[model samples]
Target: MAKKESYESRVEAFLLPLMEENHFELVDVEYVKEAGTWYLRAYIDKEGGIAVDDCEVISRQLGDWLDKEDFISESYILEVSSPGLGRPLKKEKDYVRSMGREVEVRLYKAIDRQKEFTGILSAYDDKTVTLTMGDGSAQTFEKAGIALIRLAFDF
Candidate 1:
């Protein structure tokens, strides 16, 4: 597997249990280097909405746990926040939940000669998402084919 995948796996393993215990959903994790230091961002979500207190609490606890584990040697910023309105669909469950909703998807490679599409999500199995395009055409995309998946801004 690629290094980014490995890093994401480790981060997910380390954070999921803690999130479950705290009644928060783990939306995503981004580990990237900008300028000089590495940054670790954890996107989180909960019913109703996430508050500042929620982010602060998770940040503190996860920061401590990350320090104890020492999985990352480089200096980094640990951020915990809500996924927001255009939240990404990162898991199979997420895609399933988004069925019938408008979505914007960018593919790793072109499908039918297009690399991007904005349409209504028709269905999602564990492996693929079927999108109905503006012209009433449908296309199926394996999960691995997506570069990014997010809610579309209809307005």
Candidate 2:
């Protein structure tokens, strides 16, 4: 696998169980270098929301576990935080639950000459998502066509 994919897989293996044990969902993770420091940032969240205290607790616990494993050789900063508004839709379950919410989606190829769409997520079914466009027109997109999907925080 590619370096980034390998890193993500390793980190996911190490952290997923920890997040599940704490009743939190693992939103996403990034291993990147910024200003000469490698950062391992884990975005976590729950049903309602997440708070600083939750981040602190999970960060401390996960930090202890990471230190013991020593999976990362370079000096890296670890961060655990909420996904916040406009959170990514990482899982199929997330897409299902986000029905009726606004979403922004990018497709691998243009469907009807457009590769991107932003609208209300009217429904999500077995293999497609129905979107209500700004003009009140509804369209269905196959899951395989989606390249990126995220909640649209119009607030």
Candidate 3:
């Protein structure tokens, strides 16, 4: 577990400067094994949205750097892409960006007999989030109580 985290930290350190130079926001990085294959994925974004060309450029540059560094012992596939519309709010910046947006919140335990809440993200602080529900009432939840919180897509 520590080794995986160390690898992720190393990758983040390597990618941050590259991302900033290219005017991209480094959203998240994950090094995971799936289907017997190791994959390193970098999620990035910008003011509008990321293009395929952006991913291609970052991929080429980062791939070259990774090759030069030779940090990972195992073979891995590298992917650079945008975080989708429903991306989870994993950091303070994410929450700040998501203010006033509709969000779906799942809790570790039920609140008012409900485990999930869908509402406009009215406000958030370091310790709590306030959602304005459909009935015009506001619901406040502790940050620690939330299991997951992401942008909600209405379809």
Candidate 4:
């Protein structure tokens, strides 16, 4: 596995039990490098919402755990926070829960000259997602070609 994936998987494994114990959902974990520093970020949520205190609690525990383990070779900033409203759907559970909900989809390549679409999520499986567009057209998107799929929200 790539180093980033390896780090993220290890972090996910460690967080699984903590997540269950705390009644929190693990949205996503990422190990990424910015300008010069590496960052280990955990996105979490709950039925109601995540508060600052929740993030602080998780961050403290996770930081301590990472320190004790010391598996990662690089120094990184550890962050635990809520996946905001616009967070992309990156897992099966996310797709399942989003059924029948309106979603904004972004594709790696444009289809019909458009790379973005907004529609009701009608169906999804391991490889594809079907959306019912505003004009009642059903658009099937290959999951591999999708850059992002997230619940649609208006400000």
Strongest candidate by TM-score: 4
Task: Return the candidate ranking by lDDT, descending.
Answer: 4, 3, 1, 2
Across 1-155, the per-residue lDDT of candidate 1 in tens digits comes to 76656767788888899889989889888888889877789898888889999999989987888888886766787878898888988777687778899999999999679999999999887788889999999988898889999989855
* Cα lDDT tens digits for candidate 2, 1-155: 87767777887787789887889888888888999989888888897898899899889977888888786778888988898887877777787778888899999999789998999999886788889999999988898889888887755
Model 3's TM-score against the true structure: 0.85
Task: Estimate the TM-score for candidate 2.
Answer: 0.74
Best by lDDT: 4
Between prediction 2 and prediction 3, the one with superior lDDT is 3
Clashing pairs in model 3, backbone N/Cα/C closer than 3 A: none
- 21-108: candidate 4 lDDT, tens digit per residue: 9999999999999999999999999999999999998999999999999999998889899999998999999999999999999999
| Candidate 1 whole-model C-alpha lDDT, 0 to 1 | 0.86
For model 1, the superposed segments whose C-alpha errors exceed 4 Å read 1-7, 108-114, 125-127, 142-145
The CA lDDT of each predicted structure is: 0.86, 0.85, 0.92, 0.95
RMSD to the hidden true structure, all candidates: 2.7, 3.3, 2.1, 0.9
Better of 1 and 4 by lDDT: 4
Q: Give the better candidate number (2 or 4) by lDDT.
A: 4
- After best superposition, candidate 2 residue 33: deviation in angstroms? 3.4
Off by over 4 Å in 2: 34-36, 106-116, 122-130, 139-148
